[model samples]
Target chain A: MSGSARVLGVLGGMGPLAGATFMQRLTLLTPAERDQDHIPSILWSDPRVPDRTAARLAGGEDPLPWLLRGIAGLEAAGCGAIAIPCNTAHGWFEAMQEATSLPILHIVEAAADELLRLGITNGTVGLMATSGTLAMKLYQGRLAARGYECLVPAEEEMARLVMPAIELVKANRVADSYAPLAEIARRLVERGARAVVLGCTEIPLGIAAGPALPFPVADTIDALARASIAWAKPAG
Target chain B: MSGSARVLGVLGGMGPLAGATFMQRLTLLTPAERDQDHIPSILWSDPRVPDRTAARLAGGEDPLPWLLRGIAGLEAAGCGAIAIPCNTAHGWFEAMQEATSLPILHIVEAAADELLRLGITNGTVGLMATSGTLAMKLYQGRLAARGYECLVPAEEEMARLVMPAIELVKANRVADSYAPLAEIARRLVERGARAVVLGCTEIPLGIAAGPALPFPVADTIDALARASIAWAKPAG
Candidate 1:
């Protein structure tokens, strides 16, 4: 192997399962005939980092210090670039980027890139994320900048459908999460969304528990993995 | 989260998928209602480490320097203990343990512990692993020390069934690996083995791809995960 080869760093544990699944996806997605052909990676899964949504929406402990600590840990371990799998955690993307010279792959940017790759540029896209991500406009701002409009669930819908579904996944009741999440995505498509973006890390797991949705859904976990892969293998 | 909480380090990337799956298993197997309740882990998945089986069987590159490099990196990153998921890689376990104060969980010993946990204290247990592991006597010595006899595939079965099945998993052809592996496991059971140990990390994946094996199977991936989890949570 070349000494100059990039080692991908995953700053995860926003939800431990999401972090683990992202690592699994990264390994499965990479095209490798042998072990050495796959990406070299370091996953720092510190689930103790205070809740991202709680910090964003309510009066909760700030997770920025923990995020920075993880970044520092990865950098010290010789990571070339970093990828944070959690969608809501990207609320601190700028602060994290400012703290390190290493490039952090943005979950929102990767989702937007997925939208473009799916030929949905300049179209209205439905987004399913935590209430905090919606309140912070993480996807709305990024998608809007990329010429895509985001239609999100109403507050009542978030309370009744979205938030509980996310909790079910965190609690490992994935099969039960599918119904509520799928219903909301269907409602979004009915309200004129061309595609639905599974914005939160847990949302895709919920959606996948059921049969495939008829509508196009961009999974951010997969989107982030693809972005990490792209960054790992630059054109020769 | 307590500052004194243990951080589990994984020395992975013998084959990237196995390493990634181990992380998934670790997260899923842990008893956690939310992210904070899960274990904190660092996965150093540098797939570029030279082949362990090749090094053991043929005049191939020594992987000790690379193994030591990973151990050093994890130690520097604040890991309290380490777990290596690869069965073949443990051939250099003594050398690795000598280089680091951090406790590296032994996969073979973990398997032995798992066998006892399943109430199979002293009996004929079958082991399915890479040629290197068998050649190095990693499992035989350890299992014998634990008062258990291991029945392994004959040399012809190793070439015809076991090795190919393992390779299929490595090459991402998990579904195709099931039949051959199951046939061999059945043969072992017929030859007086009580239960089969899926000693190679990839074997469990292959077994899982097909219908459930009629015989009881000890999955080392899960064994290693359980061992890692046990180390992460100490009785108060």
Candidate 2:
């Protein structure tokens, strides 16, 4: 399937609100003269699934079972492929694929490939992602092949710069809550970051590159959505 | 009840893709830290809902039933309120509230409140929504009361300037697709329209104001999201 008629299935609810946010991005990403031009999608929000970080830390509740169930539902509903928007849930990708017959798109891998194709290797990338995702070595491990060096916020930087700002949006605090992230970016720039990777989808919501940013911010969520648009369409 | 722990429900599926995109926005919008800071959300993507245009034309299947089902799910799940990202769905707001005891946030009205507060009334707003949303008078009707003159693209202009460019993103042809919308926007400025609204969420994904536009492109979405942030957590 090129683009016009492909169906997308979302295996989500690593946090329910985030799942909804991904759906919004699809609309923001698609070209529609009306709402109908948007491709149909199936989303299964299973927030009850084990917390992604907890699974990584304690091996408590695994997301693979719920992920498989959601994928099956989407496949039965006729989805062409599956996407999990949660930045952390991607850690279970191997297990998730083993559980489903349909093709599951890998967010980090997609991001790495796009970074490679964009020739973004060798720049100072100040990564902004969930603590779990950052700790998991997702970006570093993937980007290592491309020779791109990844830098994460210091522990104090995460507390002072990142988490509160992201929390503001989670708490529905939008524009005014940007100071913390902005301040963090400023420091990152002071520390010699050439570009900032909005690795967490939520970070891009209220914040974007300003004329005075430490550097340009690459919105990877937008990149993935744009990629999805390409993957779903007919060739020219 | 505030941002600290609010649950938001979404009545969605005007087209499954748009709903999915909106969900991505929610994730992007949040500023959560340890993951627990994220507000819970629920989504219902029912692609079976008749096209909004078709339903308006011949009184086809009313989407109210499905909309209500979604609202009910969120309320049942303990959502404090709801935000439906679909612009056209708001046309049925009356019927939607009839189905739920929970409060629903209206994007247009909420946006209007922000606009009025910004003192931009009587300002010329270049409308960039889908032909269907405009034809249905969803945004135009509400915007009229705010003393704003809404200018739609001329037929040839819309076809040559707007539609094809929008179709490019939907069809997933994004590279160089922006030239058309920017050109059309320049011509609209010559016609004396002051600022563009980026009315449709998807339009922002296509052509947005950087250093290129003739005037300000007020992204109403950016307004809504920013407003939600301040409203959620006012500075002391």
Candidate 3:
């Protein structure tokens, strides 16, 4: 029917809150002056996808099939492209890409572009994400390729601070997540981090709950939103 | 694959911002303590659907076919039910319901339930909505079936206050929309309205831009969100 010519599909539900927030940000960040100017999108948020970290780190159930099913659903919905908001879920990025011909926007690349946009061109950028993401070096290898040194929380900090904060946000306890997340963020700054990349989709919401961070921070949700906008916009 | 058993389809994009906000409210309002506890949903937001007001009031292109296409897509994507957030768009509720076997949650019905929840069992309730929704009596007929007496803004008030405020919200000037909306809302209250139903999807966002209203208010976005949650929840 109408507006079906081009649609961006969002593969979400790694955690429902983060996925919904990504949709909201994508709508708000688009440079449209009217309703028609906004992007056409379909968000397929299924929260039952088994934990990405558990699948990646431990010998847990496979999530690739669930991810592929979502991609297939989005493709069947006539989406020209797809964007997945969850950072840990990106562990299946390559397999998902091969499963479908629709161009899937890369969240890590978007975060790297966001770092450049924030003028953190050549300094140590702190990363705050799930242990699965760190295990894969999703942000490390990409940011390093762009000439940026990346710093991540110590093992103890991730276990004590980062992971708990992420769980709080996922459990809908966003405000309670802010203190511990902000504490770890301050520790990163103390270690000479120029700025922090909120690498996980849920981390941005947790950090946003408290007072604004003194250090420059790039939210991966916002990064992915801008990337989605860029993909939706016609070339000049 | 994992959480795809019972997906809620949101037929949105009457105006992209309102639809996105509704999805966000749906996620936040759900009684979920964790990600998997939240509902599985697919939001098909296509802003290019011909304006419902233009189509209904001015003999413009029929948006029914476009609406049907979205519904079909959601069905194909394995959505067990549907929820359309826009009040004006709900003018086609019966036809949409006829088009699909999936149970579509009614925004007006949800608003009626919200009124009872807010202790407005028997009083004049003001309505703030698009002229198309007003013309179609989406709220008037439905709420009249209940005990509530409905009041609507006069023609001039809709033209000057309500309509422009809705446009400002769609155009993303949310903060700028608060004054005129509040003014008309105040006038409605002066005429003995116990509470106001923010009938149009965009109206809630416009009204939410400023300070909280001193009077009771019900937002259809939140109402629809609750309805979706109720549908997703297992029967006790």
Of the candidates shown, which would achieve the greatest TM-score relative to the real structure? Answer: 3
Superposed model 3: Cα runs more than 4 Å off: A1-4, B1-4
Provide per-model DockQ scores.
0.64, 0.16, 0.70
User: Any runs in candidate 1 off by more than 4 Å, and if so which?
Assistant: none
The sequence of per-residue lDDT tens digits that candidate 1 reaches over residues B136-214 is 9999978988898999999999999999888877777778999999999999999999889989998998899889988
What is residue B179's positional error in candidate 2, in angstroms?
21
DockQ ranking from best to worst?
Answer: 3, 1, 2
How does each model score on lDDT?
0.89, 0.63, 0.88
Q: How far off is residue A209 in model 3, in Å? A: 2.0
| Stretches of candidate 2 exceeding 4 Å from the true structure | A1-4, A12-18, A32-34, A45-51, A54-69, A116-119, A189-192, A209-214, A234-236, B1-236
Top-down lDDT ranking: 1, 3, 2
Docking class of 1: medium
For each candidate, give the TM-score of chain B: 0.96, 0.76, 0.96
**lDDT tens digits by residue: candidate 3, B1-236:** 23435678999887888887887788778766777777888888998888888888899899888899999988877889999988888888899999999999999999999988888887799999998999998888789889888999999999988998898887788889999999999999999999999999888888887889999898999999988888888561
| CAPRI-style quality class for the chain A–B interface of candidate 2 | incorrect
Question: How many backbone clashes does every candidate have?
Answer: 0, 38, 0
Q: What's the TM-score of every candidate structure?
A: 0.96, 0.57, 0.97
Q: How would you encode candidate 1's per-residue C-alpha lDDT over A1-236 as one tens digit per residue?
A: 12678999899888878888898888777877678888999999999999889998897999999999999988888888999999888889899999999999999999988888788888899999999899888988778888989999999999999999988887777789999999999999999999999999999988888899998899999999999999999772
Alpha-carbon interface RMSD for all candidates, in angstroms: 2.1, 6.1, 1.5
